[model samples]
Target chain A: MKYVLSFNLNGLPVDTLVKATDTLLDVLREKLNVVSPKRGCDNGDCGACTVLVNGEPVRACLTIGLTVAGKNVQTVEGLQQDGKLHPLQRAFHEHYAAQCGFCTPGMLIAAKALLDKNPKPTREQIVEGISGNLCRCGTYVEVVEAIQAVAAGKYKE
Target chain B: MAEYVGQPVLRYDGIGHVTARTRYVDDIQLPGMLYIKVLTSPVHKGIIRHLDTSAAERMPGVAGVITAKDVPGKNAYGLIPDQPVFTPEHIRYKGERIAAVAAVDEDTAMEALEKIKLDIEEQEPVFDPFKAMEPGAPLVRPEGNVWEFNSGKTRKIRFGDVEKGFAEADVIVEGTYTTATNDHAPMEPQVSVAYIDETDRLAIYTVSQDLYFHLGMLTAIFNLPMNKIRYIGGTVGGGFGSKNDIHCDHVAGLMALKIRKPVKYRHTRREETAYTTKRGPWTFYFKDGVKKDGRIIARYVKTVHDTGGYAGMGPYVVDKNSILVAGPYAIPNVWVDGICVFTNKPPCSSMRGFGIINGTAADQLQTARVAEAIGKDPWEVHFINAWREGDLGATQFKVEAAGLIEAMKRAAELAGIELPAHLKAMSSRGR
Candidate 1:
């Protein structure tokens, strides 16, 4: 049986029918054609499927489709404003982070969630923020530097 | 002169990667696409007593089932023709592919795999390379446990008389070391999508290290013409030598041709870790003869490689291991033997270090032991025995542009190490 899920996605109302067994990641990627969220490990060990729901970061692979019926959902695709790159995205590019890019979307979403709560997070706090996401290319130093760059107002207007 | 040759430029795909726009094999979607799952062997060593696939074909949403018989032309494919696409008679190791089913979706496909009946009679399995080579051991391969090379044994490297060199030596060190098998553990698991394109040619999209190599293997396996298959793959999500092997491309292509629908196979993390190829384990026995003042005169090494199940690049790796058994040092008398033995486990293949890392580890340990015995700094010992520009290596190859002395000196300086006057003036030019 399929259920109709209606929610706000990236500041826009989205209505889609999804299977009961389908995950939020499946619905977003297959039905909605929003492919920013990845399926690094469907078991949720690697947080490549991380997405923002109601301004909080959660693993979309672990989140059920029906649970977010009336919630706010955000993905890496929603990070841009007026076709301009987000501060975190810009900082990631500048710092040479996101090698192989399998974990970039989830890393960006987790970073956005961290900055949303504490805009001026310390280096240690920034490290703690995106600790769930894993980049296998050993780009942890560059990723942390990118988040720290944003926190230090380097990417600000 | 090129301006950007030596520059630390940013990654070419950095922008696409950061923007979440790079495409992977899993991100592909097509019309009338079917998912596939391989039914692997559960027992390590076994004989196929009974096999049934009718139950899987009758399952809901089951499209097709392919076994060894379903292979169009050949059942074997690899660096050597020893590996089978589906083992029909005997199962060499656990997780060997026996059958594969395609269905409307992954859940249905996996359910179909559960419906297939497979009966295997377990046999004694061998896990050790040395134990496998013993007389009366259960042979993993049809010929024998020890893989033979053109020269008789797998590999044999010999030089000046080792007994004479050891007799003249004042100090000798003997040691044995073993290295464990390592998994590549790339972020992206092995996945592939196969379909016949508009031109009626088989097309495969996968994460492959070399497109031409996969093309050649698929051509030989499928008995298809060179123009019949199209391999499209360049970008990889951290292969690190794991994706060099043809993983799901051949099986997925066969299913696609049988059903005439795009077939997708995605290996889960568990399957990737438990079943796929990995770095081969090695056992090294080293005997080094050195002078009283910390100069290694002769070295003899015996290395045994555990080529699991099938000869998946193990022969080639053993050959390279034999060539590099002496490491970077300049030893006058050297004799090395590398043997590739078959064992009942996952097939071992290429990794970051083909086979040199294990030998280097053993060499470094022996160097330090020799230093300790002669009461000298390990760095000083390495500098003294390091290869010079014109020195003849154990393999009779002359070293050119030798930089070990300079590199060691620079590293010492970086680490704030102060070397004695006699050890500090070492050069790569003269012995």
Candidate 2:
């Protein structure tokens, strides 16, 4: 039996049937074709599948597709408004923060949640913010720098 | 040289993953694709005398059940081909591939896992590498180690005589360092999807670092020419070194060949950790001799690498690790040796930073000891003796663009982090 689900995703209203077993990650990946939220550990140990749920960071892999029935879901794709990339995204690019990039979408979404809550966070706060996401590349030094860059207005162009 | 070798540049792979547009192997779903699930031995070591797949073959949406008999020519494939695709006689490892079931849905393929039955004679397995090499150590492979000399337990890098140089030293320090096996734990686990293209040839998509290496192994395992196999590498979750081992991709391709339909195999997290491998545990011994003025006179290093269950990049990484174990120092004499040994642990291989991180951890910790004996600052000692751009490494060959010192100093200045006083206590005899 097909079920109907209506929700707003990345600023657009999406009405779709979410299989009871399917995860919000599956919908974002399969139905919406948004591939950024990678299916990492899938069990939620590694935060590669994080997204903005009600403007807060949540692990998409853990969320049942039906649970996000009528709520706001923001993915890495919706970070930028208009024709410009977000300041945080620009900082990541400038600071060489991302290597391997497998965990970037989750890192971006996680950082966005932190920034939205506290526009100006200390370096330590930024580290604690994205600590949920793991990078095998050992680029934590640069990742911290990139986030601080955004907070410092180093990304203002 | 490019204008930005050391300069910070955004990773090219960053844009796609950040934008949520990068495609992984499991991300692709073909129009008419089937999924495969393999049933591995529950026991550690056994002789598979029989296999019955009749019930599984008759299930709805079941394509076929493939075993060792299905593999045509060369029934084995690996960096070393001793590991058979399907075991006809004995199972080498725990999850030694015995049989696979292909069906219309993954759940069906998974559900049919219990249907396949096997007859086996269990044997006492040797999980320890050291004991395995001893007189009565039950031979894991029996025919010596799987990695031959080129891939075996030995590497050599020598310079001036070590004994004579050590004889001139006023102080000497030697210690062994051991690190546990850590998983690459790539966010995206291993997944493989194989299908027949318009030409009816196999097209395999997987997460891999080197596509050419995949082509070579797949060609051997599947008995298909390079043209028949098209391997596509997309945004791998994180290969580290696990995906580089062509196990998942090959298994998926063989199933597709037998079923003649598109086959998809995505490993669950548990399956990923169970089926794949991790970086090997290593034991490194470093001996350094230095003059009273804090100048290193000679160095000797012996690295023993536990290759875990199989030899992936163990031998190659050991060789590199041994050289790096020598440390960033100007020494008059050096002799470094490395061995890649097989163990029962999950197949060990490479991780981020390759051998450098592991090797540096051992050597840098040793150098501060040398600095202690001479009563000199570790930083001053490192700066004075650190290799310059054109300085020769252990070999006579010069190393260009060696930024060891510059990078270290610049990092210190930027972070306002001088060598922490606590690091000096690392080599102290008493706690």
Candidate 3:
């Protein structure tokens, strides 16, 4: 049965009928045409389909769409504000953290969640923050460096 | 030229990737696009007795059910055309495609696959390459386990007299080594979108390491003109040689043509791990003859590669192994034999080093063993026997600018290891 699922997406209120079985990833990518939350692995293991639900990072693939009915959903597409790239996004680009970029969206979201909580994160903390995301290109060194740069105020929010 | 050559340049697709705007195969959506799911064999080896797709065809959301009979042109396609597009008579390995369904949605396609009835008589599977080569072993293919080159023999390289070199050597070191099969394990699983364009040409958008190679494979399988198929591939998410295969391209193309709409086949993570080819495992035996002074006299390697299930680039892999078995060394006598043997695992294909990496590791390990036996430092022994200019390689190619000695010295310096004055004085040219 489909129910009216109302949620705040990128600070905008959205109302749509979503099936109970539909995942947040399906609702975002398939229904809303929001492609930032990539379906790297439908299972939550890869963390490629990560989005912020009520400011907490969650795997969109695993999160049921109905559960986010009254919550705020933020994706990688929401990162840029008024034609300005997010600090993490700029840091990622400058540090060359994304190679293939399949893992970047989720990596960026997870990094953003970490920074929002702790403004200054150490290298180890950054590693723990994005541990859910996996990059096959072996870009972890650069990813950690990019997150460090963001925390170090290399790119201001 | 030098300014750009040695400098780190930004990737052209970096911004697209960082901003989550990159269009990977799965990200592409066309109007009325259909999703595909395949029905594969569950056993390593089996004879298909019965297959009924009528029930799957009648399923509510399944648009089309495709079997081996639906292949318009050729049933087989590969580097060596041994693998069938869909297994008809016998299942070679578990996860071999038997049929596929085109449906309104991925869930419907998967559900349709479950409805397709299939019966198979299980057969004894040969898992080990060594056992596969043994007499009385079940054949993975009709032609037998070991692959025969155009010359009707396994790859072999012979440069000098093996017996004479060993007879003259002061020390001989021999060892057996084995390396496990490796998966490329790219972040993005195999995915492709195929549709007929306004020009009536089959357009395929997929992950590819080489567009031409993928195009060629598709053309061969579909028996279509080269100009008739348009291949669109620019961005790939970390192939590591795995994405070189036309994984879902041809299959998606076939479904798209039959359905007259865009069809996307995205392999699940489990399907990618279980079904995709891996780097072939190798069992290597190395024998090295060294003089008392640490100058290597001879090296011989007999490597057997486990070319799983089908001959998917196995011949080329074995040939590469034959060429680089001697490693970067100045050996007076060299003999190398690389054999590609079949097993019931997924067909192995290219990876980071192609085939030379495993052979080189075996050769180096044997070199270290030879150094240990003669009470010589491994680094010093390697320096003494390093291939310089004018050295004949395994394939009889004259080494014009070998820098093994210089590289070793530089590596030692970088590693903060203070080598002896004599070892440090080694050069690429004859010292």
Candidate lDDT (C-alpha), each? 0.88, 0.77, 0.88
lDDT of 1 at B76: 83
Give the winner by lDDT: 2 or 3: 3
TM-score of 1: 0.96
Q: Tell me, by DockQ, which candidate is best.
A: 3
Best by TM-score: 3
Candidate 3 per-residue lDDT, tens place, A31-130, comes to 8888888887799898889899999999999999999987999998889999889988888998899988999999999999999999998888988999
Query: Mind giving the per-residue lDDT tens digits that candidate 1 earns over A1-157?
Result: 8888999999899999989989999898878878889877778888988999999999999999889999999988788888888999888987988888888899999999999999999888988998899888988999999999899899994
Q: Against the true two-chain complex, what DockQ does each candidate achieve?
A: 0.69, 0.54, 0.76
CA lDDT, candidate 2, residue B76: 64
What is the lDDT, from 0 to 100, of the residue B396 in candidate 1? 91
* Clash totals for all candidate models: 0, 2, 0
Better of 1 and 3 by TM-score: 3
Off by over 4 Å in 3: B1-7
Q: Which stretches of candidate 2 lie over 4 Å from their true place?
A: A1-19, A30-34, A54-56, A77-98, A112-129, A138-157, B1-15, B145-153, B373-376, B380-393, B396-431
Model 3: how far is A13 from its true place, Å?
2.0
Q: Number of the top candidate by lDDT?
A: 1
lDDT of 3 by residue, B33-131 (tens): 889999999999989999999999999988898888878887887777778888888888999999989999998999999988999999999999989
Record all residue pairs in model 2 with backbone atoms less than 3 Å apart, i.e. clashing: A36-B20, A40-B187
In model 1, pairs of residues that clash are none
lDDT of 2 by residue, B274-377 (tens): 76766777778888888877778889998777776566677777767866778776677999888777655556666766566888888887888777877988
